[model samples]
Target: MKALPYDELRALYRNFLHSQNISKATINTAYVDTFYLWRKGSKELFWNAVTATDFENEAKNALIKALSENSTGNVSSLVNGYLSHLRRFRLFLASDGTAEPSVLNQGKTANRAYTRKKKMDVDVPYPSIEQVEFYLVKWDGLENYHLQEDALNKLFFELCPKNTDVIDILLKASTLNDFYSTNIFSIYPVAKHICALDIDTRLKAGDVTLVGDIQYVTIGDIEKNFYSFATKYCSHHNPLDYPIYDSYVDEVLRYFRNRDSFSDFQDGDLKDYVNFKGILIDFRAFYGLDKFNLKQIDQYVWQLGKDYFPKNYGKKNRGDK
Candidate 1:
C-alpha cells in the first residue's frame, strides 16, 4: 500500500466537508482533532496505511478506556466524532481506490465495542421533585455563605435572561473554561446564531432548525454542540418554553420511559429535538412541575444523573453535574 501524505489526506477531508456545506468552524475543528488522534495513534501512518486494525486498536486502547473512566462522557464525544469522520473518510478513499474496500468494510466488531462502552448504564434511582426542591432550598440558603456555590447560583440565574448581551456574556464566559475553551473561536458565531433565533416562533412551531450557525461548533455530534447550546439559551429565555436534551437529562427521561410513563415514548424519539421538547413538557405537566422552571427541572435531573452515574464534577465546574 502506498502511504498517502497526512497533510494531503487532511486537505481532501476538508474539501469533502466543504463540498457538503459543513461549517468552516466545524471543518477546522474536526481536521485538527482528527489529525491529533491520528498522530497520537501512529505519527507515521499514512492514509492508505490506515487499516481497520489501526482503528480497532485506537478505539480499544485509547477511546474506550478513556470513556470508561471519565464521568461527564466528554471523551466519548471526541472519540465518537473522530471515528465517524474516519468511517466517512474511509468511504471516500474506497470510492476513489485510494484505499482497499476490504480494509474499510471489515466486520463491525470494533464499532460494536465502541458503542457498548459509549452506552454504559446508570442504575441509580430517580430523584423526586420533592427531593430536588429540598436540595434547591438548602443550596439557596447556603449559597450566600459559600463563595463557590454563590458563583454557581449567579451563573444559573444569569442564564435566565432573554437579553442578547446577557446571553453573549454567559456563552462567551463558558468558552473560558477548560471544557469548551478549545472551541472559543467558534463559540462567538454560535452565540450570534442562537441570539438571532426567534424564541416565540420556535415555541409556537415547536421546531428549532438544528442547522446553520446553530451547527457552528458541532463537528459530528448534534446533541453536544447545537442542541446543548439551544437548550440552554431557550431555557434561560423562558424555562417553561424549552427543556434541555443532554445525556444527563436523557437519563431522567429514559427512567420514566422505561417505567411506561408514556407508552408511546421510544428510544429513537429522543433524537428529534421537537419531539423531545414535547415529551419534556408533557412529563413536566404530568408531574405537576408548573411551580418549578425548566432550568430547575434541568438542574434536578442533572443532579440525579450525577448521583447515579458518579461522574467527577471538578471543583471549578459550576451548575453542571
Candidate 2:
C-alpha cells in the first residue's frame, strides 16, 4: 500500500477530535494550527510514515523539540493536543482511517496494533482457532461479572434464561440496552409483538425470518426495525443457532471481508440475520475455524472489535440508524 498522504490522515484526526466532543471553535483555532505546525516541523507523513511503536518511542521528544523551535505563545496546549491526536489517531488508524470513523464499519483491536514492516495498511492477523480459544477463555473468566454489559447479560439470563413467553422477550429488549428499552413505552410492545408470534415453533425450525419478524417493534404510528435487538433476542433463545449482530461484529466482519475476500456481503446484508449468519459461516470455513461455533465467533469478533474499533462503539444503549 502507498504511504498515506499527509492530508488524508489529517482529515481522520479531525474526525477523531469531533468524536471527542471538542468544540468547532477549539478545533478551528487550536487543532487546526497545531496540526499545521506538527505537519511542518515533523517528519514526512508523520505517524503514517512509521510504526506506532516507533512513534511512541521517538515521536514525543521529536514533537516537543519541533514545536518549541517553531511555535510562538503558549506552545504547551498545542503540544498536548498533538500528543492526544496521535494516541487517538492510533484508534483512528486501527479502524482503517476513514474520512469519518463510522465508514470503516469496524475492525479488530489488532487493526490499530503495530506490526512488523511491509504489512498492508491496517492489516491484522485474523484469529486462528487457538486465538479464538484464548478469547473464549477470556469470556469464561469474565462470567457472572457485575458491571456494564456483563452485568446486563447476567441480569438478562438470570431473569429469563429461556424465551418461552412475553416476559422473556421483554427482559431481553429492556435489559440489552437503552436503544430497545427507551422506557417501558418501547419495550412492552416489542415484547408483545414477539410473543404474538409462535416463537417456540419458529425457533425450533431455525427460521431466519423469525428474527426479522420480531424486529418490527411498532409504537403509536411508526414502525422501528430493531434488527440488532432481534438478533440478541433470538440468540438468547438459542445461542447455538443464532449469532448476535452488533456494531463491533459488523466492523470485524467488514474488516475481514476487505482483508481476505472471505465473502461478497454488502453492509446491508449484515443487517439481515440470515445473510449475517451465512457470512459468518463463510468466514469460519475460509479461515478453517469450523471447530468453533457461531456464538464463539460472535464472542471472538466482538472482543476484537472492542480492542481495535472502539470508536463510536460507546454507550450500549445507542439508537439504530
Candidate 3:
C-alpha cells in the first residue's frame, strides 16, 4: 500500500466525482471535510498511509465532539457523507491503478463508525387511512393540477418510456421535478439501466427480482437518487407493485420494526430491492393496510417520518416536494 500524495489523490477523487455529475457544492464539502481530517493527523498524509482505523477514529472523535456540542444529529449526517466520499475515493484510486485492492478493502471501517452513532427512536404511530386520504385529496386539488401532472408524466416517460403505468400514477400523485432537477444528467443513464432489467418477468413468476435488479438507482455512488425516483415512480404507477424505499420510508420501517426486532434497513439494503419491497408488503399486511395502495401506504409512512424524524425530514430537504 504505497502512499500517494494527498493533493494528487484528492484531485483524482474530485475529478471522478465531477465526471459522475455530482454537484459542485457536494464535491467541495466532501473535499474540505476529508482534507481537514487528513491534515489533523499529518500535514502530508497519503491515501494509502491513512488506514481505515485512522479514518474511523477521526469520525468517532468528530461524533463525540458533535455530541458534546449537541450537534450530533447534523454532524452524524455529515460524518456519513464524509465516509461515503472516502469509500468512493478509495474505490476510484483502486480502479485507476493508484492504490491496491487490499488497501481499498481496508476502508470498510466507516460503516462501523456510522453504526455506532446514537440511534433515533422512530417508533411513532403510523398515519391513519383518513390522514392519507386527506393528503391525497389535497395533493390532487393543488393549483394547475392537470398541467403539472402532464409535465411530470412527460418527463418520467421520456426517461423511462417502458414504465407507462408507473409514469401515469406519478403524474396523478405529484410532480417529480425535484428528482429531475437534482439528477438531470444521471436520470437517462439510470433509466436505461432500469429499462434493460427483467424485473417485470421475474415478478410475474412470483419471484422478488426487484431486490437484486435495480442497481442503476445508486449507480456511480450518487446515493438515494435511484430510490428517490423509484419510490415516486412505483408508488404512482402501482403502489402495490413497487413500494417506496426512501430514507423516510426506511425510518417508518425502523419505527415499526423497532431496534430489537430487526436492524435498521439502510440505503445499502435496497440493492436487494425484493427484500426491500417485501418488508413494505409485509408491513402493509401487518398493519392491515390492504385497503390502501402501496403509494398511499408510503404517504402515510412518509408523513409519519416527517412528524417523528423532523431533523431528517425537514421542510428544506429536496425530493418529491
Question: What are the per-model numbers of colliding residue pairs?
Answer: 0, 3, 5
- What is the per-residue lDDT of model 2 for residues 1-321, given as tens digits with 9 covering 90 to 100? 125566765575676656643334434433454354346765454644234466654656656676667654234333433554454455555654334433322332323331222112332334566658878888778644224456555655576655558776676777764633333455788878877886877786678888889878779899887787788777766678988787778877887665445677888999888899899888877767788888898888877766655555344332332
Error of 1 at 209 (Å): 5.6
Q: How many steric clashes does model 2 contain?
A: 3
Which segments of candidate 2 are over 4 A away from where they belong? 1-121, 143-165, 178-185, 316-321
**Residue 135 CA error for candidate 3 (Å)?**
4.7
User: lDDT for model 3, on a 0 to 1 scale?
Assistant: 0.49
C-alpha RMSD (angstroms) for model 1: 17.5
Candidate 2: residue 229 Cα off by (Å)? 0.3
TM-score of 3: 0.43
Put down candidate 1 lDDT per residue, 1-321, tens digits, no spaces: 235577787787676655543334445555665554456545444342335467656543454454345422234323444454556465665565344323432354433332333432222322345556865665556543255434434564564334246375444335333332233334555554555653345544434554222434543364344545455444434455566566666766776554324335777776566677777767666555657776676667765655443445433322233
Model 2 quality (TM-score): 0.56
Model 1 clashing residue pairs (backbone): none
The alpha-carbon RMSD values of the candidates against the true structure, listed in the order shown, are 17.5, 14.1, 16.3
TM-score for each prediction? 0.43, 0.56, 0.43
lDDT of 3 by residue, 1-321 (tens): 235577776786677655543344445655655554465545434343334557556555653454335422234323444454455555665465344323432444433333343232112322344446765676556545445556655654454434425443333223453433324343454555555563445433434445344434565766543545555544433445666566667655754454222335564564456667777777666544577776667656765665554553334232432
